[model samples]
Target: MLIPLIALAGVLPAPALARGMDEPRASLMVGALLAFAAVLAALALLVQARRLRRRDMQLHARNAHLAAANAELREVTERAEAKARMLDGVLAAMADGILVVDAGLRLAGWNPRFPDYAGVPRRALRIGMPLREVIRLQAEAGEFGMVDPEAETERRMAMFHNGTAPQRLQRERPDGSRLELRRTPLPGGGYVTLYTPILAPAAAAAGDAMQAAFRQEWTSRIPRLTAAAADGDVAEARAVAHALRGVAANAGWTRAAAAMEGIEETAAAGALTQLRLLTAGLPQDPAAWN
Candidate 1:
């Protein structure tokens, strides 16, 4: 609409100029002026339209890049959050008591196992409560180690700051449960204390049974074979030592099994005196047989 109006205004000026010229010349000059003006207007409009179109293309490209970057950022954030949730689940499910303390020796975070092992209610745990104070209270109540509380607290603090030594200690609960305590530093100016319960008597008994079986079938055979060698029964001694070697190897006692192998080799070589010497210091108690 505006282009046509501008073209009409240009032609109107040409007619006013034509009044001063002869008829044919006036008509020709008017036509030339009208054509020139129309060409100039069209060129101006073309340049303006090209500039607008280029601006629109640039805007669309910038928006697409921003949308892609935003999607990537959202994906990264979601993955990080998922990992954090997984870590939280793992910590919650752990049997060991875990407590995180800040640089000021104040409790920052803890697992449910903390109160369970400490024999205290969960309400006793709170942020900003001094770690030394908690340790002292628990120790006094026989929840922690037998060491002097003040000295132990100082040692832990020293270990935390130095990073050269491990902050490990032992504690016995009132229920006769033993605990192994260790403290590690967190990345952002804090520390974590982990309390792992020592194996109970029932579990220890089961382990002892397995150990006893191994010893009976292997270690106990050594002395008997040596006695047979002393009695001048080289054949019996060699047979017994060879049997002990197989038993020890099967029980995963590699070093002991190797020793038995060496003894068998010596017996095979008729070195009974060496075998007697090796077994001389072996325990004699019946309980030691196990």
Candidate 2:
């Protein structure tokens, strides 16, 4: 509207000039100038729109990347937490005393057996607790038996070098239970300690008596069977070999039982030659049997 009005106003002054017809040429120049300006404005708007569109696309791409990264981070965190929970559950369920220590010698974890053995509450355990303090507590509780301080220090040094050592100790419980303690190192770091109750005196004696009687019976039988085989008493040797085979198998001596079975088979087949060869290698002293 402004351009046309200006053109009209300019023409008003140029009516006398319009009679000569130079005004039409002047108006045509003005119109061309307006069209050029409009074209330039359209190009400017198009360029600006393209720039905005590109910026939006870039923002969307960046946002998508951020979302993917956040999702991956969340998944990693969840997996780590789940693993920690599982490890905690397993540690709590174990009957052995497990202690995890860092390279700095600070305690990282302790299992229930720690309190059970030390006669202390779990709350007393702390992250920065010293190894010496733990040993002292057990000693005061009478949990460590006959451990020489110098020997203990040497053993600890050995453990640091070798990564593990099994140490035996005795514990007298408040409940009157006698416990045998064994301490071993964990694979990667730290240590594990186990406490097993010693059998009662009467039960120990009974087991020893049973074992002695079995040993005596085997001592008398094995030699007689070997002698009978040497004397070519094939029938008596076969019977004795069968009995020994059963005894060996029952006692979890599978290899010895198999050898006895072979002897029995050869004897029963009347192959007295193989039976005599087998008897020749039999131990005369039961003490050297194993």
Best by lDDT: 1
Report how far residue 36 has shifted in candidate 2, in Å. Answer: 1.7
Residue range 9-120, candidate 1, lDDT tens digits: 7556455566667889767766776777778778889999999999999999999999999999998999689657645655665657898989776988888888887666
- For candidate 1, the clash count comes to 0
lDDT for predicted candidate 1 compared with the true structure: 0.72
The global Cα lDDT (0 to 1) of model 2 is: 0.68
Off by over 4 Å in 2: 1-21, 145-189, 192-290
TM-score of candidate 2 against the unseen true structure: 0.51
lDDT (C-alpha) at residue 50 in model 1: 100
In model 1, what lDDT does residue 107 have?
Answer: 89
Residue ranges of candidate 1 with Cα displaced over 4 Å: 1-17, 124-133, 136-166, 186-189, 204-290
Model 2: weakest 10-residue lDDT segment is 4-13
> Best candidate, TM-score-wise?
1
Task: Give per-residue CA lDDT, model 2, range 1-290, as digits (tens).
Answer: 34544544554534566567676786786677667666766676788899999999999999999999999999899968965774555455544556666555557777677577566567878988866666555555555455765556456556655656447778587667677767665577566556655779898798568656646666677887888899999999999987876655444344556677788878888888888998886863434545
